[model samples]
Target: MKIVSSEGQFQGINHNRAMEPAHQPVYEMVTRTRTRTRTIAAGLVVANLALSGLLSKADNYNGNNTPPADGGYRAEACESAKQYHYEHAGFNAPGNTGGGNSRADVNTDTNWFRFPVNFQVHMLSTNKIGATTLYKAQMDQLDVTNSNNGAIMGLDPSTNSTGATAVQTNPAGWFIESFFNLNLRQSLDGGHTYTPQPTHVVLTNHNPPVFAMAPLLPPLGGRYGGETNSKIFFCTNFSSPCCTNGIIITNVIHTGFSTNFPPPPRGSNAVHTFSSTVSFNISMDNGLSFSAASAPAVVTVSVAHRTNDLFDPDTGRTTMVLDTEMTQLDISGGTLPAGVKLRQSPAMPSDGITTILSNGPSSYMISSSFNIMPELSLDNGSTWIPTCICKRMKHIPPPDYPSTCLSNAPLGFWRLNELSGTTAFNSGSLGPTANGTDTSIVQGDPGANLTGMGANNFAYSFNTTAFVDINSSSLNLNTVTVAAWVRIPTGFLSAIVSRGTNSWRLYIDNGGHAVFQTGQGGAAASTAPVDDAQWHMLAGVYTSSTFIEQIFVDGVLAGPISSATVPGNPTIHTQIGAAPDGSQARFFGDIAQVAVFNQALTAAQIQTLRTAAGGPPSSPTPVLTISPGLGTSFDITCFFGTTVQRTYSLSSSPNWTTIGSNASPYILTVTPTTNAAFFRLVR
Candidate 1:
């Protein structure tokens, strides 16, 4: 989630300036470490390193004084469709994702990235597993429109239990990869017409360059001899030795299981043991045209610094954007390198950071958020149940479910991305789903070239006369918060989500301002006009206890609030895309990611919602604290990342440029021509 400040749209705060956010960003610039570029010994030496412990360093690989080639990486032919057999198999592989990293020119669009992220999808709940069929997982993160910038994100599908692999076999395997010229398809009819409706499928570009291996999946299958897809596996391949190639992997995902195996417990990981490596299957070929298990002695993925995986061959720079929950990250590296930077992105995410260790092989990226206890999600992200919510859950979560899971759970979430239906599926578990009684499609941002609903990226297009109405009793509120994304054309006026007359409404009034009004008294705060046919996230919080209405636009507080106190609870049914009764000015655009919270969401929580759409915004330069040291030794500090270069010149009006990271204790001849000295860190 990045801070999205449309220039001239935000008040006071400059979206162009990267300032120290409320979520203090700290950067330690110890620019006295190592040279930025390391000239590796010529000739490609493909060698594989072992995972964990100390990584293997190829002899004569670093420091040969021979500059690395500027040619970017091009993957090799699928290196044998055969599976990788355990422990240490060195068949000419680069130590790292060979090459360097350059941030000079790279695409960060949501549609450009094809990450082969093998992640876990939890769907079955203990309550829904008995005397019936298996309940599949539903995600609100995928599907939406007008996604200008971000990454084309997705995960490889592993066998639920089919046990499919490249060995001409069928617990299945998966991979996470990147794709190009990707196509996302939709259908209106029940799987028939191409008129376009709902559900997203990544076609043609079936495989994309993989970024990282995600957390593993738990054991599948039910306890009462229900379902087969037991076991999980992942298969990967190596491309031809090129300039840039790498894939990061997180540590094992299944924890708390009584030994990665079965009696299976009454939980999600009940079918197989942790030791069972039945799912490490890969096709190296274009899909192996068709690809299982037993805890074979597998190769454990070790921590490797992938700073070598350069986006550009000519440039070698490493950059990591700071997140709200960014921990004190110690980027393990040949420190003080020229291209390494822990900088703040103009698009700052209220969510969290992606921690990368840059000292070894391929840098590993791991989410810096607190791990929540594994629980049950009956409906998308609407509700959650703790205390061992998987199957046959007699008792497995130990004492009980962690508070973290429930504390952040949503009461009702509607990711209105349906293909052909009058029903707007409430991915949440609140009450019965609200029904759209008119013609409206959950298809926005269509076409292969356009960005699809990237895991909660798209929205429901209600350009016609259609609306979603929910029963008032279902969402009766004491403490309320309503949030949703809207893209309205000029002169469009309606509610994104409304609670009835004089209640709480996040809408565009006739005045054309994005407003959040609450309390029985109808106190409201209207931000700048947003009827410019662009997407915006509006969140409204009304605390009956505080008798105040706080509104946020794009995660930042709206115009100043002058409250006229009013006390009372908000009641009445809720209607989305239109006012109650479905008449009187419908929102003439798209609406998505509508969430109704019983608890008033904090500013941080709202920021998470505001990150629904992200693109490159202007970044403010960083400010540094400089302090002169003994003699010529100088020190600098700031809440910033990136290299700090100090240039001294004997001539004024001299051409200034970044210094090369060539030597430590930087030997200066100190000729008579070198007299004047001035220093400032430029971002």
Candidate 2:
């Protein structure tokens, strides 16, 4: 595919797909053998030094640095396949607009090489490409910078191939100043590399240039006798000497591609070698050329808020300012040429002025920042109707904390409090359990530290030997949801939570992918890695209705779903950070706000749970109190609406056995079979 401006000054081409090289089987085998040999040698050396009581700290590998049980492996092939080297093109300052000075802003655009395998290119006014340094999994930094200011990139939406085009302002101070001097580049190799094309002039003196492109669907009209013809939209502030006036002018450029011309050799002049034609229409009437703009005044629902603080140096104080933001675009008067009509609004509020086209000619959805709501036009902008794609749901736990919300109550919840002893109390009705010795609670993510939410204040850190066990019959449910806020600094194979009998397991594999497993079927693995030392909400859901298991990362579905039936009555005990049998590997990271819901939660409910857990802390936490009921007996009491179970043993190293369920003011009669006895409750 190739694109050029109306004046023929800018041009770009798309390269067909090319397979990335893969590692040889022999090389992989040899590497594995070598790693094994080294591991054995290191083990022997450490064993010998240990016998002499002279073991070096470097020789101790049983902790965080321990190699994987199978072998030490790196994703060299996958990393290479997705890697791309970038170069800086050189910066060009914008012309002075009548609106004063133009401030530099960092902008980013991304395209999927494939689902879950995509690259994001960033541009900065500083004239650097790849504004943020790209780092490999092994922490090696790649050299790249922004190539131009006010740069915009677009991918050919018609094909799955890695064909993309980019446009930027020229830095040469050529005819018509910076605005008219538009440059273009094309990447046929999935953004791995780029070939520059001849510069194109769109108009004289334009500021705040913006560009967007999409494949022309059937309803929007046919491509230029080819499978790929993309419509490009460019917008900018028009002025005589550049930056003199703010009249918004837009251009709709239609590009046609021809396969008759092969890609030019690297470093060759792309404009001279490429074969393509461009037709465009200029609209000084604010996007009326390609599409009609919605009326300026429309009704919209406020979805979120953006807050900023202004510092008062004189008073040594700061005043907070808030701006109400619209979630849907108002496109009351939106219209697109003969064949195109808007269909849906942007998926997110931050997405400014999203336009989606449908199959019928003249059907389109246009959302603008100032519009009250997204406007949909079915008859090619001849008519407009208000539409609401996303409906706001009521906030959970409503401000008044009504008792009617118990249906979504959690079966088990651990705040992972550092203030508490080596026992993680269940905020729910479940009883507490003895936490592993190698576990410690530390400060949690500050963004999640809501004042009233006790669990958000701290998180439990597990060494290789750490785990927490809760023995409860109520945990055996067919439909269940397990969720937690976790941060893993290093990727390792370890179970985050598992049942003793392997009925279910939520774990991270050596590849750093999150997996959800039910013994009845195969495990589901997320496409994205969650062990990047960043706080993420991980959830595994099993619903009996569909017999399907799902894994979610940060409230979004991460991977393919799996057909898995959970045991109706799984009696096995639960373990966190270790296998159910306490024999397999253990998790080495921070976990907080672990919750288990007996019922499979809907997507919205899961999102609500995440929002609530991360929201501002709530008021006074409910306390669990234990006091002497009578001699050698104790009374445990807590206000809870769910079932609570108790476990007791006669020694410090207690053999926990689940007791009968009881209400909040239950009394436990302890008969000491040994020197001392202990008791705890869990929901």
Candidate 3:
């Protein structure tokens, strides 16, 4: 039955039908939960923690990471990526990731061996059904950072989706939990010991939650077995938020044989499959600007990824070949041709893909799935020792926030970007919804696309008696993080996010001070006033390991409650903009981007998320221009919107005399202290 020929366009080769030739000895695929050791090929084992299914590439080192969960956004016939990594978890390369039956080289990753893109999610408790709503669940494709002309390979059709296309498919429940969180427990000491870390994966967001699981890539933390009966989850359940029925598919790939590793060695220079490195760009003036990036310190050698051929049943063989893999970027002395600067600043006003925060005068370490056990590492680009990649959260541009929330692999994160509906989708891995069905909580605020751009980003307005609730068991553990972007004009100690006063709560105190309540006897309040009629980010974090709770305002440590243990999560569900059950301490404010995590997020992660939410609306770095006035006086002009808030005021120093508030283009007549006196505008 296997007598055939392997020649030009050998019978088995079609993009649609991914199958190998019958004559040639097929390179068997191998897949196993490898820890300190990995297999290069069939029966070929190698040492060193490959970090398989952990961070970057697959074991054999293929650049393919696209899974069915990510294939819906796939484009076609594209070469270069608009940006290295869009803040949101999306991309467009060639065709869909040629997953399932074959691991081929479609448009295999090509942005160097390095890929950088964080995922952002907004929990939509209500069905997002507005004209302007992102329609995440029904998403086919939208504008990524810049590219929409590219393509992406998705899961093999062998595993049909049960929701949208049940014709010849079947989805499962593994998508939800895998999206929750993932951590790599390293054992640099030759597997003698490993990091004492436990991972609770939350692969949230529409269908096909994650692209790197099982057949996509061996589980990084190992083939996880369910907690209850000790069995690996392998089904596509559509009951959870984001994981609801949609266009995005949740292909339950079938895997049993590990004949060989995922990416078979294909090229002459391909030593091992994976290539890992960290590159950097030089920023001189703090974070204002940066020089071109150079990977002088990066220690890695590029390798060829897996390639895919097609199958044809008509001729008893196939004749079409396709590169189903997301090929790796070509590197030259650590630096690649493109990816220094992305998406012109003018292109994307809100959360533009600029080089502003991408560059640093120093090296930056990045760690995924925060608050996990993998913390320490010896990253020197020399010895491949277990190194914990850590870095201070990037400082966001003042007066603006990221288009979405900063979700560095959290248990749950609700961006609350839904324009209309009773639901704000949780963008984190957690598949829970943040329901705002309360009558007092109003959606679709006025001028949502303009004035409410940053502060709101389609935020929900909570009236005096309104509140929102969350449905999920992800937050039922010790060491938690609760953060949100809020604007409360009045100083009332109301709950911004709480599960009733008995459990934990993040709210405002008697004097506009931000507070984080751990329990009846443990609560931390900010010293200074934070409610000044503007939007501010409030974060509450409790570390069970240390039994400490902290409060942060606009990403700064406002107060820390040492030796404070968080009480057990109450039976009541989590709520936003009001107290749990909304029976007491109702809130009157605007809230957006609510993030909850089972593990305590680092100060930097919280700070990054805060800065991404416009920091403090009051502190804006408005541009001021000064020119020659009538004769002696100089005309100093700054932006003064006609809006009632943020009026402009002119003040000068001879003794610092105030010239009173005025409209934009106001000219003042004053002589110079020497030739010119410094005039400042305060709003």
Candidate 4:
């Protein structure tokens, strides 16, 4: 590949510098060895000798003659190669150091090219020269007929590390040829080795100007099924004689190779050589094959151009000329034709051309230069959605059920129950801490009946003295949402979760309403009582932009109140199940499935959390009736479903203990010892 600096300087070749006046021959002839290598050496020697003899005799062997001023010599000698260089002047070649009037004044500096090849690992550390081989072949004077160009590579995300599958472009012959062969090679061991696949003729007598490959992030379903895929894009000039006349067309070929790729006979290969177009070929199976190319999507843009002043040595005349410049479109969005969606991560600028290092499924990054806003899809590439980088949040559901919310790539998440030690693991960077005593993990609440009541579960029980605290410095959220599944039997004013000094508080009010209070003096109360002795999903939202505070109970919006003021910056400790100040109003309940979001959640996200925790009850809410039974005892009767557990606390600030659990309906007699004790049912 050619390497040029932004300043128009070729890496090894000196431009605009006069050649040595000595009359030595400018071309090197390769001696044919008995080695069995027929691909490169033999072809190069013959082509170089023939061109050298013709140019040497014409230029009088001076090596310093300038192009003729009349541009007449160019028309005669420039017949073979568009990019070839002559030892002596008189022929105006594009970007030639020798004075010449050329049509294309291409920027030799800004254009940087990387050859498809692998560097020997051992040669990397030492100064020793190691053997090198082409990752993909390109046409040169040496290999005139059997040459490949426009080589690109992509990695299969699903199989990247252990034994990754790599796909690369292999176009045969020169662009000027009448027929062009489109081929590909698969490498089971990354790009260290390759196996040539079947070749297909994409165009007859047409020039495929460019080729590139990128891994297609499979749709969410494909990811679930352990499948991976990739795409290849090529721009073909459909104009007559190829490269000189018709509109440039771009098309994509998709391949799926993961083990779980869809069933065979998936889709047909698409080949269109008319008009300027952009489209993709989709593959349902992992790179095993692809479908016919989709209809082209028209993208209107002027063809790139370069201008130069050519001086013909023979005529001593200078003329202005214009030449077509090759352009590349680096795309990174997840939108494709035919309603397929692929999951995409946030746009990363370096993802436009993926390398061996950054080619994993979940870990890959993507970016674009043409203001192409990178989007991701959950269905294959059919639809697209914009996404931002979430910074500070933790959403932890039960272990067994995969969370769709988390799949959207949240800032941080931790299944509090899945954690041990003082540190709570966050999916993102910041990890919170579980501090103090009196906190213990217990049996989790039952799941929503839709998926079986006890399918996925886990919970954290907090006594009056117990609480979990996350450092305020770790998370400084302005607009925020904190949600949890909680159960409190007989609750006075209690803080379920609080951060900073009056910054935000989600708690049960003295009257048993779910209340959310923000520093902005905005307080929202749920329409229904939450401390009714059963499990309920509650969420508190504070949006600084709107200066509003809201409360949600069991997926339904309870109250949305507006206030001009917003909470003060949370610069102190953030605590769950207790006040941030360590004052009164400690929570006394069973808390499960807590999520803290850096941004205020929408109504839909809150409902999703409610469903994930355990959806709203299917039957009418059962009333807990406590009445005096026989001597010195009170009987507690309530409707029970599946496996609800009953627990009671003797003292107002006492540690609660589990009493009993049953699937059948029955009346339980509780003998109370304290004057002010509480009883509650939990699921």
Q: Each candidate's TM vs. the true structure?
A: 0.37, 0.33, 0.36, 0.34
Which is the leading candidate under TM-score?
1
Clashes of each: 78, 38, 87, 44
TM-score (C-alpha) between model 4 and the true structure: 0.34
Question: How would you encode candidate 3's per-residue C-alpha lDDT over 257-354 as one tens digit per residue?
Answer: 12212332332222223322223333323224434433321111122222322232212332111112112222234442333211111211111000
lDDT of 1 by residue, 170-281 (tens): 0011111100111122333322332211111110110111111121121111011101211111112122111121111111122222231111111111122232221212
lDDT of 4: 0.36
Residue 228 lDDT (model 1): 23
Off by over 4 Å in 3: 1-406, 432-436, 446-456, 581-584, 614-683
Residue 311, candidate 4: how far off, in angstroms?
93
Give a tens-digit lDDT track for model 4, residues 104-177: 11111111111222110000111111221111112111111111232223222232111001111111111110
Which residue ranges in model 1 land beyond 4 Å of their true spot?
Answer: 1-33, 40-407, 433-458, 520-526, 562-571, 581-584, 611-683
List all candidate RMSDs to the true structure: 24.3, 30.4, 27.5, 31.0
lDDT of 1: 0.33
Alpha-carbon shift of residue 106 in model 2 (angstroms): 45
Winning candidate number (lDDT): 2
